[model samples]
Target: MSSDSTKPEEYLSKINEVRTLLGPLPEKSSEFCSDAAIARYLAARNGHVKKATKMLKETLKWRTQYKPEEIRWEEIAREAETGKIYRANYTDKYGRTVLVMRPSSQNTKSYKGQIRFLVYCMENAILNLSDSQEQMVWLIDFHGFNMSHISVKVSRETAHVLQEHYPERLGAAILYNPPKIFEPFYKMVKPFLEPKTCNKVKFVYSDDNLSKKVLEDLFDMEQLEVEFGGKNSDAGFSFEKYAERMREDDLKFFGNTTVTSASALLTNSDSEVSDSENKHLEDKEDEKIKNGTLESSLDTLEKPKPEA
Candidate 1:
C-alpha cells in the first residue's frame, strides 16, 4: 500500500517516477509497457511509486516466465473439457468481449491444469477482441459452485495476477446465483481487490432485478446459456463446440483464417447467432451499463486508455 492521494497530477508524477525506477523493460513487453501502463500500476498500488515499481518489475518477470501470450486453445484441452470457462462471440453494449465461467464444471485434477485453462481463456478472449474492444465482461455462473470447487490459494492467486499483471483489462464482472455458503470465501477474497475492481463487481441472485436487467440489456439472449438466463442451454452448453467456434472467432477477428463476407460474424455458420447481435447499442441508449455514477469525475478518470 502507498499514499492515498489520487489527484490526476499526482498519478502522472508517480507513474513517471515508477518508469524511472524500472530503467529498461523487455522490448517485447513494451506492447503493454508505457505511460498508460504506469497509471494502472500506480492506481493498483494506491499512488505509491515505490510499491508500484516493485509490482511492475514483478509483473515483467511473471510475463516472461508465464509467457501468457503464447498459450493457445489447443494446449488447454483438459481445462476446456472441464467446461469452466469460454469466450462468447457476442459483445456487451460497450463492445467489450464477454467471458463466461461456470465453476460447477470444475473438473480439473491439478492446480496447474486449472490455472493454464484460465490463462488460455483470457488469451483467447484478448485474441477475439475487435479493434475497438480492449476490456472484457466476466459472467461467472455459480449455480453448482460449492466448497469442493473452492480453492482459497487459487482464488487469491487469480486476484493477484489479474489486478497486478493484467490491470485495467476488466470492464465489469457479474456473479450469478452466488450461493449462501460462498459468503466466507467472498470475505477472504474481497480484501485483495482494489477498490476500483470491487466497484466493478456485481452480485446477481435469481430473484434480483439487477440480474434480469443486466442479462437482457448488455448481452444478446440468443448467445447466453439457459442457466445464465439466456435462451440457448441444452446442447449449446457444450464446451467442445464452443472451443471450435472460438477458433472461428480468432479467424474472423484475429488472423487464423480468412472470411469472405464483409461481416465475418454475421455469416459465421458455426455461430448460430443473428445479424442484430453484431450491432452495439449506443452508450447513452443504455443506462444500466453506465454504473449509475454518470457525474463523477473519478469515473471519468477511469476511461479507457488508447490501445498500444
Candidate 2:
C-alpha cells in the first residue's frame, strides 16, 4: 500500500511518469490511463513506478491487440448459453459488484472462447463498479461439481489474464460448498494465484456455521440467491433476458464514452491545468457512473445457471 503522502501531487507525478515511459498511449486508452487506473497499477506493484509502468504498458498493448473492451456479447453469447458466468444482479454489503461463476455449468470446448467470455465478463464487471468501489466479488458455486468438470489449462490461463491485466479488481471470491474432490484441482491452480489474489479466496460450506457466516456477512440475505444460503428464490438465469441486459449496457458504455471523451478533450486542452483540477474533473465523471448516469445494467443482470 502507498503511504498517505502519495496523493494529489505525488500520485499524479507517478501517473505522469508511467505515461511518459509508455510514450504515446494507444487510442481509446483514456480510461485505462486515468489517474485512478494508473494508481491501481502502481499499488498492484507495491508503488514501484517502473514496474507499474511495465505492467500498464503490457496491458495497453494487450488492449490494443486483444481489444478486450471491444469484445461484444454477441461474439461470446454461445459461450454464455450454459450460464457458466454472468454478472450478479446484486452487489455485496460493501457495494462491490458481484460476478457469479459455475464450473459445472461449463458448456464450451473451445479454450479460446472460454477465455474470451471470461474477459467479456471482467470488462463488464469493471464497467459496473460504483465510483468509490474499484473491485468485485466472485461467488463460485460448487454444487454438483466434480473433477471431470475442471479444466486446469483454462484455470491457469484465467488466472494469468486476471492477475496480469485486471490488477486490484477483485475484492473477494467465495468458493461455496466445494466438494472434497475439488481440493487437488485447487491445489494445482493455487500456484498460479498471486498471494494477494489467493488471500481473497475463501472456502465456505453450507454445513459449516462459521464458514457459512462469511456469506451472511458479505451479502444481504434478502438479495442473495437461495442457492448461496440467502433469501432470493426467483427463477435462475434466462439467457435471452441476460443477453438483452448486456446489449443495453454495451450501448450505454459506448454512448457514455463518446461524451466523456469529448469532455476529457476540452478539459485536457488547458496545458496549465493543475493536477488537482484534473483529478476533480475525473472524479466527477466517476461519480456519474456511481449515480447511474452512465451506469452498468448490473442491478438487473441475471444469475445462477440453467446449466447448473
* Top of the candidates by TM-score: 2
TM-score for each of the candidates: 0.70, 0.78
RMSD, each candidate, Å?
14.7, 16.3
Count of steric clashes across candidates, in order: 0, 0
- Estimate, for each residue in 107-190, the C-alpha lDDT of model 2 and write its tens digit: 855656678789989999989999877788999998788755654445546766787788888888899999886665466445
Q: In model 2, which residue pairs have backbone atoms overlapping below 3 Å? A: none
Relative to the true structure, how large is the alpha-carbon lDDT of every model?
A: 0.63, 0.72
Q: Which one wins on lDDT? A: 2
What's model 2's overall lDDT?
A: 0.72
Candidate 1 lDDT tens digits, 178-272: 98776655654465466677777778877987667877877777867677777866534576688788666556654654333322222222222
